[model samples]
Target: MSEPEELPQREQRESTKKKKKTKRSGKKKKEQREGEEQVEFEQEVQSVSECVVLHGIFKLGKKSHDVLLTRTKLTWTPIIPENPTGETGVPQSGEVLLQDIFAVKVKRRRAAGQESGGPVLGVALFWCRRKGRRLEEDTLHLHNASSEHTHTWYNTLKELLTGFSNRPTNLKVFINPSSHKKEAVHIYRDHVAPLFKMADIRTDITVTERKGHVLSVIKECKLDEYDGVVCVGGDGSVAELCHALVLRAQLDADSPEKPVRATLPLGIIPAGSTDVVSCSVHGVRDPVTAALHIVLGHLQQVDMCSFSSHGQLVCFGFSAMFGFGGRSLARAEKKRWMPSSRRREYALVKTLARLRPEDCQLSFLSARKSNSNLFVQRDKDQDQDQDPKSEGEESWVTNQGLYLSISIMSIPCLSPHAPQGLAPNTSLANGSAALIAVGNTSRSEFIKHLKRYSSSTGQFNFSFVETHAVSAVKIRPCSLIGCSEDESEEEGDLKTTPFIHAEGTTFPWNIDGELVEIANEVLIRVHPRLITLYGEEVEEAESSVSCSCI
Candidate 1:
């Protein structure tokens, strides 16, 4: 009986030990699955058909990594050594897109006393990473001891970079030293030039001394030597360049009948008080962002307007303003001795204080309207009766009245004052222009209208405001003595007289932030896809600052 009892106790102990071992095995399996899942989550899935260009072992920092180069990206995974248990550690892989890479060079390790020669280590990659609205540069180094391996990798990368045909290798840069607060030169040197150099881009830089220096250089310079033209200044400088480029194209074509599209694209670096053109193009007034856009070869074809007076081409511009806008710019030009911000503020306040409207006639050729009532059925019989050619003709709309402001914009004029742009409904290559007309309104109401531009909506909701999509516009300002009887009656009760120029006097017009004096009627026509600019389309422009002068 004692022996049987001892046997039972032994059996029970064996059973308990077996159960504990089973539980431990199950826990280990669960942990292993989770680790596998984590690795899968961290690694980008590769296609079976994707071709691997190169694979090698490289040292990253103190750890060895397995590097693989594919057609689209470069990936690196850390090598984890297996322990005595035959279990390996998980790997967290990283990758960089080939398109984001701007430059690659051989990394060298030099001795303290050595200045010229050094031993080849590996390759260093320079790239740009998007951070919020801007791009920041980053670098990665692959360490290796073999010089031949590093040279091979460098040559492969250089060949790959050469395949990007859109990237500009040579550029002509114009810097305006007098733009804004006189920081254009510094902005270019500190932000733009370094990026261009890193990308191995050759640039011919010209520091503009006077107002029209850029235009003169553009006219005489050998444009064939450059891939593009870069303007490092404000909107005026950009407009001047645009005009010069268009003129150069016309000269090259030797045809006055119609203007040809600009051959080379233009890049703008914002370093001014109001960088509307740059903001409109790049969606932000940032020099680094602009430089990156150019290096990456982002192209956007934008519509341009040709401003003509008395059948002579005055200039080519993206936007123009008359009436109150012109008066304010004119005032700002006179106060050149003051600081840019102060001058703009003073001009705005003074112009508003002497608020007045201009009597003018506006004739615009409207763009074809899309029928909003899609559900409505068209009468087949009526459609058959209409002439087919007549359907293609867009009718001209005419209106004559007292207007406080008139704006014709081919590109959305975006700035801090107007975050949504002065013409929010317009697009870059829409083949049309936004014609905004501000009819006669009280000073307070006009101020309200101006303030609404900073908001997202309700800008053109007032009864006195009108907006139209036009392809061409003709504006004729009526002299004070030539005003209609009803117009003269409307001006009788105003506390201040209308700010009208004397007979035969030149009228001020604000064309892309530059003041122009025109003595006769002006005609503006939109040319679609006229010039290629270095930027991407901006769906919505954002601004952290707002105008406080109001």
Candidate 2:
């Protein structure tokens, strides 16, 4: 060994071997750490209830929870402590965390292939409760495997009896399984029920039947006892709720017995076809995110508009319209047979096919000071004495080419889906209204403007469109002086027609995507911001009703 070069060579080889071994060992340790971290994976938990479910186990990441759940069902049995936790094999530590909780954990048999036949994921879960707060986290719970398909957590064991959570809200939920789709129930049970259990929210769920069925339930609700109304449906369901609000307001109008109507925020679950308002307010209508919004919604005032079709309390919104772009909506709805995209395409084609010049007399109170009345009155007194019967069926002909649309908004954006982005900045307390006229020059102009609206990149060119901040507007077309036999009978037709010094009615005015006959006159009184709707959606009508009452 002392013989020089040979000894040096051996030492060099050993040193190199040692380095290689150490590197391999360090790499193995790194791999192990990585696996551990994977077990620790989690989605950002916004729900405090969810955080509680994972109590005393920060070491077990959300992914681990999933893994544990998956193993028991799709793979292996759930992990159990060699010594059981709590009364039912749950660690005593599990009870310690839940000691602060007071919830009702409901258990029911899974419907035939339907899981917890209840609103829960067909697996029983109680809405959770915790003291002293409104917001809650989505939670997780552990269950024991059983031989019977009907076993439930409710009334099954002592631990279930003692370790419950308490909360503030008495919740009542209405789910229209057919709101926009048929799978709404399934979506609610799976994602919503777990959090309900962990947070221990008290809930009563009723599936709806028939159209406007929700309205019927809410009409009879002890509205004060329940803190909020959560509808697991789509816009139509939301519309029903709005109606309920209006009806409640109407009933309470004269009675001092009326409770101070606070804006009861609505919770929407996106289980529908066109969740336009939900998407507009919250961006994407994820069930989880929407549930989060439900927890987060606060009261803010938004504007409302009141209108009458001859005086029968017709409805209008902060955004009012009855013209070209609106007709496109009617057109789009017709192509319901096609996929939404295809329907949109066909609507665009038809709209282009029907653009033409229009003429009419429009009168409104000028935004500027003038020796004028507080209304728009045409100087056409000659028509006062003209034979009313002469202007009949041809009346439709006169108004034909001159389609009109008017929109009144407190802010520039009138509605959540008005070819504009969501969250239309509406003020419910501001009592102002704006009127805009959409003019039809030619098919080319109509096509150009419609395309702009569709792309969400258009602006109002005052050239063809005139906008006025005003109190009232009256429009009458002269092209159809003798169009219909009914029109020839002035006394009969004028009473229900769309125009009158104060009583015209027979015209069809489209209000907020709906059409109503003004069989009489219309004096659109702009009742400044009158109602509170955060994401106004269709609730704009509630304020409209209030203003019309005024």
Candidate 3:
């Protein structure tokens, strides 16, 4: 009787254990089903194609994850056995845009646990990670169990990165090693060169020896041999390169042997006292950001203002100014030995030492009337339209005044001092320039207007200031000739003569932060989309605070 009872109890114990096992299996299957549902929903939202998905395992630190690669992005899903349905594919740690990929290399490592096997392959993926104020490079290494599998993954990644666009293969880089806090060389080696290497771009780097050395090198170089020209310096260096390229293109156009229509595009890697171009183009003052733009083959057409004095191309740039702006730059250039922290203040003080208005005659052509000549096609018909009589008005509407300054800007002149840009409303390829003119005013009032540049609502608020959208403008300095009533009657009896000025008085002109030669008159013409720069579209420009100034 005791043996029979023991047998019955053993049978019942076995039945209970079998039931528990079945319940556990059912719970696991439910969790897996829910996880799959979440992954399917995420895949649908991401628009990932199932046909081209490449699956692999990646270990980031101690956590292991399963990764899926699409043509444009990589998504990683965490492999959690206990809590499969808790979190799905997280974008923060999972998704990486293919456009941000810089390089994919195969790294070899010892296979510790494998028996009689050679080195295992690991994929080292390097990419640009944009953090608040700058870019940080981040790398991820995925170890593969087999060498062949690692190579396959690497090849797949390479094709995906290369398939975005026809990226440049060879480039000519000009670095100003002595400028921009003297970090140009270090920046190139540390940030820019590694990126070029990863993109498989061959670079021919030329370190600038002197102030104007880049111009000569560019003129002598066979520009066609390289895909693009890069300047690793400040605004001045970029301006120099721009002028050289424009002059070279002009020379080629006049050549009877080889006629070229456009010049090579320019890329700027910011390293200088003032990186206004880089600030304006990339919306940041980071060298790595500029390098990424170049590697990706992003091209943007920027407006270039052509300045001629006495039938000679005196200067050309995206931004220029005469009067107070020019005077300030001149003063700043002279105080180069001053500490960087005090240089700006010193220059500002010197410029304001004597508030003297310049006697000048200003004239401009309305861009609204003739937009084609400024942007698209400078046809013969447009030239005919320049005739004042044909357009039912004077070709050049002249204004005479005692002026403070005239700033001609084609692009948004962004700088550390002016974070919102000098011409915040200006567009990059728009065939027009912001012609801001300041009339003679009290020193206190001028100070008020100047102070507005630091504030969003105040820059355009003053009554003595005027701004226009112009296609072309000419400025001629003149001597103030005060005529008394008696002298006026002696000379002419009919009409009272107003105080007039004589022509030929000269002052400085600032072209992209560089002081140009003193000239009696300056002529600036706008060329719509004249040159292509490596940047994003004008539509992607940073959105500034909007305020209405009376």
Candidate 4:
């Protein structure tokens, strides 16, 4: 009886072992089926989402690749050869976004000394790649021996590029030969022209001969023929072009007082000493980047200020400065024989040495408070004390003081000197401008304030510094006799008279890096989204300042 019981126990143990093995095998089979289903589903989804535009085998480097083109991207997978053991290596793929591709051309091999005739080899793709804050040109060669194949790909790519409606097909380019270091022509020829040609953009280039040459040309030229205007120079050239464009637009609309929006966009290639406009707009003073922005159709609508004196329009500009800034620029203009950088430095030093406050009456219409942190935050107590009336009152805020420098900026005015911009609390287009007033302060304190612009914060933290979001501003400079007795004592005796003009008592003004002398009060009114420029909205600038003078 005991032997029979032991045999049944052994058989029961065997039965249990077999059932466990069967269960394990079923699980493995289920996993295999699920993996197969997953692959099938992925393939179906890919097929549904992407419509293959073209597929072919081309050589990338030494290896052949299976190239596939879709509406969104172009992908290439390396084709590995099978070994003698009937095993193939894993394929690696590379891809580029369709939008990144700017141009496609048929690669060719020509005989020595031959300029035009050549045999088609493959297709070459020219694309823009973002490297840090700049856009750089990159090229990829897809080698194929058939001319027909390459031409077909090229035509398809050309058609696709043409579909980008915002991209300019024709551009009117102006290069200021007298710009910083006189390299504008070289910059345009070497760096800018190739990119435009690659994108099949037709450009009518004009190398400016003298001051206001571009303005003269723009005034007479037919603007409708070109998609946009490109200026290759410094802040001054850009400012001039902006003024011309706005003036042209107003003339076209037959309403000089009621200005209209610019019809075409403006592109800036920085080749000047201080490319504040370019740096402010593109966040980098790079010609290649500017060209790429134009090619990619990046547009930024910018606010402009119409400077009017006694009801007559003085000019249209993005930024202007009075007092120290204007004096420095005026001195720099007198020393035209010196290098651009050295002249500016010398002028800065001289101006700082003789820094004197300009007694002026400032009045402005404040912008309504908003949630945007870009605007300067005013002290609640100060705001209430300055204006006791209700918030609904449209009365202008008035302030009278001896200011070292008064700046009104529609753009941030980014440059090597000021990384965050001279007016940090400003935007490209927000229907307002930043009005910054620096009350008379010690030279050391003023230099500290200027140096703070290169830092991340605290540029306007000092008690002497006042910043406001304003829709309009009026600046009226007063003679020395107009200053109060206490204010005059506080400011000390003036070293040099502010009135410099030989013909009349004219005050120097720096408008977008260009010096202008004006007599009497000037009214600056903000025009929102007045002109479209070829750049993306710059949210922040790279914190880097090259100037160490401050």
Candidate 5:
């Protein structure tokens, strides 16, 4: 049965070859027709010439292929050993997209028992490709015919990658191994570093030894050497890096002491407990997503809130809070011994157990007289000079109330806990913050407001909660001697605000995620577009009027 089938198969092959010879003329006419019908871009590309040709092994495979470099891509065709003197067996095994190639470099392997390397020429390429909806990366290692061939290939590819501004060629990376979940280093190794390699970015990485270590290093860094700085940690780490850049710029400016905006854009890879900054910027806490944004050179401007107390600069923060938000963070700090997964829940439970309203004085100046007249008066104000007026001419609204929470956010403040953001309508670089003030309310209602953050339709659904867009705010604690030390903490009993027995009482200020030391009166001002970050543009919808308690 095998012999009979084999004989017919040979006859079929012969008949197919004869048919190919007869149809050769028709095939050429068909090819011409197809070419004429092709897109204009394809017809234009046909005139481009092949740039380079080299023999190399690709992607760690043993067999070598004849690689052809064209203007737009590198195509590899397998060498048919059996038909060496005949036509190539395979048309084209694969092709590498030149635009996707992030890095190209020459490499060498050392000889056995010798200090010197061999005469073999090798090249490595890192490139990205889309797999379904996600971007994937791979490195192709190839052996060129000679050292000159390897150099020529590397130089040509390098030139192309350099021309693409989307890829960052050099970076200073700060990895905090002790951030929230303490997984920054691992995340960088697993997800971020490979992408950088693919993009051919040179990185100087520093695993911070202690808190504020990155700040000190950035202060003394040669700013001209690196393209940007990357923070591989939580919001606190990103904030610290931003602060360093701001301070460095201020020191270099003509007015050394004045607050200066950060010129060097920041790239954040989320690896902490609650990566509010990263989540808000990238819409996710995934490290690879942030890394891709950096490689692609995506830029977004964000405001920074400068805190001043007693006419002295306290610190800079993307977000600030002094009420329940601050209290929950302060409470979370004491439970450091608890497992990370359980720590936040335990702290929230503990803080809620002792929840109460605090009496405070809040004063703020609106950037706009009213939201209704925002765009209507913009051109008129810019066209005419303002009339000179005394400082008293500026209107500031003041309110005294028993408040559950007061949070001022410069960014959207998006996180897993609050996808709509702590302040849902907050703009990223609008030169204002979303100031949310919650009046004294029952515990159940306050909990409901908190729950609304996790939902899209009703974040500010309570009458007790109010949100306003403001440029500046002054907060002063009204009741200083609210609770004593023992009275503040009892099993299942909680205190409203942090108490101090000193001359003036101080309450914890939650700046970003890290808790600040106690302070009495704090003034916060939002600087417009103060810092640039490698982030995608955020489409924010003002949802302040979207929903109300029913």
Candidate 6:
């Protein structure tokens, strides 16, 4: 009995020893990691007396423009010369308003005397009416007060302090990079970080512990404390931020107020393979070039699409990318999906294109879209508020269809590698999208047809492809038939099953440039001037066939 009692004590001691040993080992590993990290603290600029107000204008939906006012609050006394006649600068559409208010810390001593710690900052509201290319002198008036023009003394002070900023101060940056490209992190530190410092931009970097690490911080972190947010990857990184924004916008209810998002202008420092948003905004693919955008602070409002589900229909922001042949073959390989130590490689020729099936028909919205299998870029979308196509001249078929890509870009330049850009007639604020359709029978025909669309004369200029910046599309499965009528046969993919009945009303929808699954089909609409980004006027894309084929 005594021995048994001792045995129990020994076992308990052993268990405690094991736990202690494990804890020590874990702590050692963590310490090793900390010691091995070569990251050094870099000092950032902290304050600025003067600030420049950068006004960026980009259209979102058709006619709406997002106005960005960036500056640090300083005593702004626009030197107005003695001229009742005029002061010239502000655009024809804009009027300047100034308010005079005093912020005096005052206390009354039982109505006996005035008590004060300092002077009360008194603010007076002044409106400078615009007539032609000049502004009439600012007057103390509240007439025609709109939201943009009205502000309490407190808010005006906040705006003055936050909007315009000093070089390199009070900037909190979140850059948790997840890159397939191995060199992305090094590039950020070596090349990108230096440029940020040169701009006098102060930043605190947080390397991610895991996926969505940065996202968690963005969602809950006090955005008011930060002046701006910058991302450091490709479209995936931008997609992450967009997801955060979309999530926050819906955090309260189905549709929450967009929040004080201007304080959190999404900044991208591209360190990803496909830096779609970065390239599109600045028209430059290099990280250094991307850094320059931060200084410019040109707010451009690009279009974003929202997707949900419909009954037996698929929808998305841009397009549903269905790969055909080469593109399909490249993506179909499992190895390509895995992270590679080196650059992800693919066959120069169209190995993936071999999967293309000739016997296929495009069935959507009751239109029997069939022809020689080719690469087609949808150029325009007709008014959907039309009579449904009569079933008279229709033959329904589906399956063995190689690829279908759906997209609605506010601007034309999709990515740096995009062979074709948004249509010329299309506007960044157009509140629409462009569709690309590739229909080809053979690999040879597919390449030949696509070449025309990618050349100096892009898709809209080419005949095979149609480039339309439209609303959205719905995808459905139909009976597959042969080239001739009455030759319809049920293919495995086209077969009907209750569970997999090709009736998934909800699936993943691609927004911006990433894939996300929503509860319902998507109806991508351009939010009229929803956001503003730092940008310059984009030169029309010049498609050059002079380079090798895409």
lDDT of each structure?
0.83, 0.45, 0.73, 0.83, 0.74, 0.43
For 1-550, candidate 3 gives per-residue lDDT tens digits of 8999899899999999999999999999999999999998998866754445588887766677788888777877667665466854543456787787878888765467855545765788887787644556778777665777788889899977777664678899998886757889999999999889887899999998987787788778898898888989888889888877877787767853221224777889988765777877787777888888888777887777878887766767888888788877778778888765466676676565544577688998776544422223322233322312223444777998778778888887776656667876666766677788888776667777876665654576677787776777899887666563133234212222233434543567889878886656788877776677887632122334322221
- Put the candidates in TM-score order, highest first: 1, 4, 3, 5, 6, 2
Candidate 6 lDDT by residue in tens digits, 368-421: 221221123322243322222334554333333434333345555534335344
Against the true structure, candidate 3 has what lDDT?
0.73
TM-score of 3: 0.76
The alpha-carbon lDDT assigned to residue 45 of candidate 1 equals: 50
Error of 2 at 508 (Å): 5.4
Candidate 5's clash total is 1
Worst 10 residues of 4 by lDDT: 380-389
Question: Candidate 3 or 6, higher lDDT?
Answer: 3
On residues 1-550, what C-alpha lDDT tens digit does candidate 2 reach at each position? 4679788899999999999999999999999999877665633322322332111111222222222111011111233445454444542222222332333344434667875444332122222233221223433343323324213333332244342222225567888886543778998898766555554456789899887677678777777776566778765565555546655655656533222233455566767654544554444555655554443333344334456544445543444445444455667666666664456557656544443222355555532221122113222222221111222221211122344354544333322233343112222333334565666454455445544533344435436655554445555543433223223333211211221222342444445434444444455544433333433232221011011100
Error (Å) of candidate 1 at residue 395 is 3.2
What C-alpha lDDT, on a 0 to 100 scale, does residue 171 get in candidate 4? Answer: 98
Query: How well does candidate 3 score on lDDT at residue 77?
Result: 67
Clashes of 2: 68
Q: On lDDT, who's better, 1 or 6? A: 1
TM-score of each: 0.83, 0.51, 0.76, 0.83, 0.71, 0.51
**Which has the higher TM-score value, candidate number 2 or candidate number 5?**
5
Give candidate 2's root-mean-square deviation (CA, Å). 20.4
In terms of lDDT, model 6 sits at: 0.43
